[model samples]
Target chain A: MDVQAFKQRILPVQGRLFRVAQLFLRNREEAEDALQDVMLRLWSNRQQLETYQSLEALAVQMTRNLCLDKLKAHSRQKMATDGDFPEVQATTATPYQQVEAADSNELIHRLMEELPDQQRFILHLRDVEEYSFEEIEQLTGLSVNNIRVILSRARQRLRDSYTKANDYEADY
Target chain B: MKPTIEKLLEKYYDGETTLDEEKELRAYFQQENIPAHLQSHAPQFRYFANARSEHPSLKSINALANRLNAPEPNWVVRMGSWSVRLAASIGLLILGFGGGLVYNQLRPSAGKGTDLSFISETAPEKSLKQTLAFEQLAKTSASERIDAINQSYEITQADQEITQLLLNTLNFDSNVNVRLAACQALARFEREPSVRDGLIQSLKVQTDPNVQITLIDVLVTIKERRAVEEMQRLAENQEALDAVRLKAEEGVQSLNQAGNAPS
Candidate 1:
């Protein structure tokens, strides 16, 4: 896109881009960094964005791919900025106790850490973002059936980890 | 009735599922009946799809974009630095030249040098009278030369400069003709009180016996009877070498006979 068009059109996506960056990076500065980086990438390839049928999906994919690259770069730089703002690592505890605690939300978030990255990733696309199996297949290059099986198996794993140890479902 | 986990896995892999089928998969994992062995991996499926929605403010993005796209100021900046370097080099050149000028003004100019040669070439030509007068005195008696020396003697400042020049030239002139002329010119000064002192100095220290013999001849010719005692002293000195001592003795005898001879 021309400079004028790129500035006008892609500038609005800055919010969404930072959000995607924050999801992967989990911090303010890194999110900003990721937003700017993705903006620059999108601005540079604005012509490709014009050809895409789904602006939201493409932008989402672009932002997430950029976020992935940013994470890789963060790892390559030898210091993860994800928790620089103040984050506690998953503490030493069995999953049962972690789920039973009052911080069960954080506990659920922590469970994502234990899952194989692809399993967690498929579950996230399917359940959280509500992308269809076809979209997941497109995003991950996995077959639609493979996306389903992976999502199903991943859900089973989640149920097994978060279920109360005594087989009861009442409040802790 | 639903199949177990294996059946669910098979249906998922076969791409056969309703909305209820997916909900069942989620419920199956969310249920309390999951065995202990599989419980550890459960929340890996927390459907984190909505997590990427955080954002920075619009103001911050605009500020960052402005910083990234900032352009430098115009040519004045780049040319201005080069101009400073050029000015400094010129200033140093001028400073060095001024220092050299001051140093030259403070130092003495040796007489025989390129500056004198340049001055001589560039200075106005001398008047005809000054030239002829210089030539005539240069060929005249020492007393005449002494009278003529300082008339235009801006170039040299030695005391008794005329006598010094005559004596030096008489000793070094390659032409026997010039040597004879210098001797004849100095002959008159042999009796002058100052030239007599210079002649005595030449007799005492001069190693050239020929010049010594000629000086003796001039002393006798001029009847500088005052030099007799000095010649007699040189004659008796043991340090006087053979030929020079003999010349000194001859000079003394000539003076003695001249002193005693009738008028």
Candidate 2:
């Protein structure tokens, strides 16, 4: 495909690709690099890009694979040892409530980090990006039922972890 | 949490919720007024919504596009071959002209310069072969090619090759410094109509503000009345750099004055 065609077709989906990368790698710079690399690969293959059923799904799949290939072991190690995932602000609460809100935000990210990679990615695609089950299935090469099961398990795991953290905080 | 939301949340974590029900669960958690016990789950919904807002920079997007969509390999190979042939022919033409100029310089007393006759008598076929050899050097050293063009500039009174090189350089060289230097050299040969036209054309297409301003300055100094309209258009363009617009405005005024004055 020519550049303008590629830009119109694929460039607009970069944010989704970046977010997926961020979800997988949990580092903004690493995610940015992964997205850039994926975009370059997509561009080189643009001549055949249009034949794909969903460019967005393909891009997301590429970003996921790139980040998964290079995700740092230390990040996984850090999550287990320190429960530190990068800071993410998910609320517009007042400063009075922001401390509590931010704590939960970090907790959610950490919980996801602790989940199995497939479950984490499945939940992210469905919950965050809001891709349909069929779309997620096509991207992930999983059945719709498998996606539902993984996402359900991922949410339950998140709830269990959040409860444990809350209990620990209360004990302190 | 509301009883309905409680039911949806339960269905949500049980692998039994439909997409719509899951969205409802997400919406319920997104609110600020969820029961304190369920507040920790709010971020999971919030993360999804916030992550959607992430955007990579436009610079990275364009860089990827440029790198990946570079000219096709066959086109590059074809252009390389064409350029080599063109450069070879141009080199021979310049060498033949340079030899004639040197011969003229040595033969001030016509037919009295026997010492250098052998050098000037090199066969045209040999020069063609030498030109092919020089073409190899030209591909290796762009600086050498530029130097050859510069040497041609010295003999501009005899031919158009120098002006052609200068015009090509001004219009197409990727290096701003080379184009800037070419603009300066073109000023010396402003008597050439091609140089005058090239300056105006370059003004219209050149992206560099420095080159635009220089082209305007040269056109104004030469009083090329034809450039006034292009300069006016450039001056009025909002996207043109401030200095370039100002220089273009000045060029139009000076060209108008030069037009009104009697010879």
Candidate 3:
């Protein structure tokens, strides 16, 4: 984990780290924060690289854990502010009313904005990151059954929601 | 018994299936003969396995590489810092937020000492309060005094509270490019074990779809096997969002390749 080697090793994964941040925090700044924070830890803990059988796996573990911590802190901070922060608006998109301008993808994002945080969390990890049931179980502390049931329902809801949202739009 | 699609799907996420089983499952998914009831599940299942198949945005990666790769330039940095400071001061004067204010505002923060000067210049409204003493000293009314405080001493207030505060302010930055840049600059820090943990936590939970996609890309590049596992687990979770699960699957495939690569 010398400096240059570390850089080369992680350069391959930088995109991954940012993607994790983006997916979880839902904000580029937060994603970058997550990315930098993860990198800083990796740089400082160069000595501990030998502890894991796979450094890349270890890096993923580290990122997931870091994101969890950040998310918790963020929630706590948000509670402390008595809802004064404008963070909610940034994350929660207003459903666009105009049919012509609203694409299916945009409708989907809008629908996603309305789902409970927990469901969204599980869905992204399963579909986007493509972790295993056991892997998801390990990260979120949920059982494999719980993960599977949740994912099945999430897609159904998305397909339904997508259809329902654009029912009146004239199909081309 | 030889593996069937169901068995492979059962262990698909846990990494239990052999490489061959995975291929078989993918092949089954790609075929047109799946039962009608199972047809919907077909895409979802194929999606989880194929999730890792997505590519990430390279433009941002290249910029990140340039930053990480450009040697520290310490000696040059040491020598140039003095001139850079002087030149920056003159440039600030030309730009005229006052030399000190612009200088304080423009310098990249080290996340340690408070940049009161920068705060005073940038976040004056948040930094200033309507003190009775200030009211007495001023010729203005209470409302006017508040207005003056708001206008004159708008400090950005970098303090012990900065990490949280700056992290919060970072979200609403009017300039998307600056927001993106801050995100890029923060990538270096993922290397720390604690920050690494913090990042993982954030990625697991944050709700913004746009941001979620970005995180998936990072995981792919980092190739963290466990994070890949976490993502797969989420995909398997019935409660997980469709978009998020999809992103997780893509991340997993990317990491699988990176992880299982020929060394």
Candidate 4:
């Protein structure tokens, strides 16, 4: 596609795409790289881009795939580097200890990162991007009910993580 | 407002709130005043607000525009327009490299004259080794590697091995001149999918003023529509060289026109 066409059609949603990628990759640089790669791929296939049902959904799907691939590659690299060591769990910190930690922001950040891929993605699309259930369903190719279930689970996990962090502070 | 917000928050937790209801909940939490009992969920609401505020770097968008807009490289037009001067430069470059055993190895058939097409025909592994050599040389000085790159360009075509070497040099070569030359060499092979990708990728990591300018020029001259985004990015970077930034701005305008004009 031409520059004007690309900017008009694809550039508008880049922020959402970047946020979605960040949710999965959790690294700004990697997310940016993934976005650029996705954008380039879209540009290359511009001839067919118009054929897609929704360009925004297609962009999200591409970012999801790219981020998943990046996550897999990252895990493989981690495995290679951390041979014989068990993976560290994010929740290893005792509930009391996590609450005692002063930075709730960091706690929430870690908890969000530790969420299941699908749940985190759903949470990001709904809560952060504020996309409609129909839009989420379209983008994710999951039923609206399934998305609501996953999103509800993600919210519960966040609320639990947040309360656990806060309750410790309240107790002490 | 408090009762309504509390109800919406409950529904939000259950993922039962409509988008408008959730938006209402978000707006309420963003307000300065909140009942003490309902303040507990403020952080999660604020997190969503912060996340929504997060934006992709404009620089990336500009780079994307730059890449998508760039016209497909016309090898025939480019080669025809500059072959003689390019050949002369290559002759000088080969001499600069001291046409030694390496040159002999580069040209297996002695009678074929000085055409560099044979360089592209060289074993792919040899070019990979050349790229590796460049990676090691990057530690010493990019200046030292500049001559090696110039020599390589004279012989190497747009083959996979040479493209990798040029890409590495473009991104990692410390010397601006070497990177600039790499940009030029890569520009010639922009028709190759790999080379095109390498050039686009180089724009992200490249920081030097001269290399950035050369890369921008190559992208614009080739009518790379996607480069409008990168040009926009360069134009926006306060730290970028003023001249380069202006050039990028001008490129964006011209490319925008070119891309938008009737095909």
Candidate 5:
């Protein structure tokens, strides 16, 4: 593909690619960097881009792989210096403490931050991005059945935590 | 209607619901008065809805695309012509040196005043760094602009141009981190009246809560009394974030107290 074709086909997917990077990297600057890197890769391989059925799926898969690589490198550096792998801590707070401290949206954000990386990515893809199971399977290389199981677990976990937090407020 | 929703919720949890059913669930939760039992699920759906709005700046993407598409220079042809260019540059250097020697011989009085040359020599170096910083600030990458802001610290003199550039960056940069860096850099020149006024004005326009809070803190640190009114407005503005509002309220109180106290 020529430059104009590359821009038309690949440039528009950058927003989705950025979000995918942000989902894995969890930092805006790094996500932007990852997006740029993925775009560059796509540009170099533009000749073969038309062969793919979906450009967006290709962009998303590339973003996911790149972010995972960055995360792996980051954790390796952290491990070398800190001598321990970072753990995801469940930050529990009293219902009253959070009621006035953060809005419900912020509360949900904190809860989502605690989710495992796979579940978080799957949930975001399925719900916010609204990708069909087949599309998600194409992007993630997971069987549709496996994707559903992960999605089910992610949703239930979010529901349970969200209810536990707000149920206390309902009592008041 | 409640029974149907409950059944859909079951299907949702089991991952059996189609995209349309999930959309229905999201739409139902968006209503103001959701049933009490279903209230807990509202935030997650709201989060999904909000997440769709999170997007990267397209301007930066276009900049990246343009940079990638720009043609690469033909280095092979340039290398083939390098010998002629090198010979031309050497001859020009010799001619410049000979002309400078003759001019020096003809104007012997010029050497007596060393201060003039000293000023001329140092002035351009300062402006050179400033010029480079100014150009870097226009680049699309956030980190490059941040590096430019850091470079501004080396420009020892209090320059009006640098101050204005930093103010514009603090006020209008698309990236939050770049704006934050500009804010911190501006604080170093708080003694300048324009810097002080520019920061106070910035508080009125800044929408990001982090930038707003930082501006408030910088204003309070610099003790700009005029900022107290802006802080009051921010505190009273219902749309401001809760954390920002609280900070502004605190800022108003402290500035008022500072005003009443004797130095």
Candidate 6:
């Protein structure tokens, strides 16, 4: 793949790739960095790019792996510095007033952020990105049936939390 | 039609809905007059619709493309393996020695009292980290800049320079998340008069819903009464998204209530 071909083929999928990165990283800046790294890696391996059946799937997989690596590195650093300043952690905690005042959209966003990482990522790919089970399997290396099960669990979890939160709000 | 929609919702939770079925569900939820029975599900679908629009900036993409399109240096590729290894080791040695020399010079003399010496040892390290973080904020990659802001948490003391940089980021950073992080970081220095004024000013310029919401949250948390008018402006801005406007309105109400309460 020449530079022009690479741009034509890969640049268009950056939005999808970036969404995957953000789903995992939960930070736009980190996701943008991950997207750039994925693109650069794909370009360096452009000679073998055509061998893949799905370039978009390849890009998503690379993004997911890069985000996982970043998460791992972040956790490792956290562990090394554990207990150094517990008060500092408390500063970022959501103010209680905000919780009482959260709108439905904010409530749902918080619920989504609280989902398990695997479930959240699958939910994002299926519902937000609208990837098919087969496409998701290709990207995640999970079986199609496994993907369906996980996606079901994710959807159900969101529904459960959304309803529970609304019910709590209704009581007030 | 309601029965069909209910059936599709069941399939959606079971992960059996086809892409088209999911689209139909999204469209149904997007309507303003969704029945109360189905209203709870609307936010999730709305979230999905919003998430679909999340994307990186075109400027960053173009920058990455240009960087990759640039010609690679042939000399490095042409170097022999042994020569490359030798050169790398020599580079590392110089860097190590030079870093050690700088550290020694930066370290305070050891003969002082233990408490004073301890404070001096940490003082330089904090400033060094602050300097590195300030430099990182100028880099093109938003991630590098965020990392720089994260480093500011370690400095303990509220340096005027870092506060100004963060305020600048909150007002002007191209990435919403970067600006949001800056807002959160600034909350640590909420007591500073300048920081409070900067945040109140930021409420006027921020248009992104997420950042606007966060700025309001931070301002509210710090009980910045001055922010109430700015929040009222955002609340009345017709162009603002419903969520942002609602948040601003709520912020105004809360700030006003707090002001009225006898301390």
- Interface RMSD of candidate 1, in Å, is 6.1
Off by over 4 Å in 6: A76-102, B71-263
Question: lDDT tens string, model 4, B23-132?
Answer: 88878876656788876787677667756766666777777666665544544467766997788899989886777767777676663653454443554435434544
Show what share of the native A-B interface contacts model 2 retains.
0.70
Error of 4 at B79 (Å): 9.5
Model 1 chain B lDDT-worst window of ten: B123-132
Cα lDDT tens digits for candidate 5, B1-263: 89999999999999888999999988887666788778778878876775666666566677676667553233445765696798889989999999999898867666646566556445543443454354555644777677777776766776787788889888888889989998998999999999999999999889999999999999999889999999999999999999999999999999999998965
Q: Report the C-alpha lDDT of model 6 over B1-263, residue by residue, as the tens digit.
A: 89999999999999999999999999898666788899878889977876677668777887787777663443345566668888999999999999999878766454346567466545543443453354444655777667766766776778676688789888887778778888998999988899999999888888789998999999989999999989988989999999999999999998898889966
By DockQ: ranked, best first: 2, 6, 5, 4, 1, 3
Predicted candidate 3 versus true structure: per-residue lDDT over B1-263, tens digit per residue: 22466566666544355446656665676554676544434544444343344223455555555544453465468779989999998997777867667577766464323566554435443343222222343443445433433343223333323223222222433333433332333344444444344345546664555555565665556555667767787667667679888888888887888877865
Q: Candidate 4: what is its chain A TM-score?
A: 0.80
- Backbone clash numbers for all candidates listed: 11, 2, 120, 25, 0, 0
Q: What TM-score does model 1 achieve against the real structure?
A: 0.39
**Model 3 regions more than 4 Å off:** A3-9, A53-57, A65-102, A168-172, B1-60, B70-263
Give TM-scores for every candidate, taking all chains together and pairing residue i with residue i: 0.39, 0.53, 0.37, 0.51, 0.50, 0.50
Better of 4 and 6 by DockQ: 6
Best lDDT among the predictions, by candidate number: 6
CAPRI-style grade of the A/B interface in model 1: incorrect
Superposed Cα RMSD, model 4:
42.9
lDDT of 4 at B77: 61
- Which candidate would rank higher by TM-score, 4 or 5? 4
Better of 3 and 5 by lDDT: 5
Q: Per model, how much of the real contact set is kept?
A: 0.41, 0.70, 0.09, 0.59, 0.67, 0.75
Q: Which stretch of 10 consecutive residues in model 3 chain B shows the poorest summed lDDT?
A: B161-170
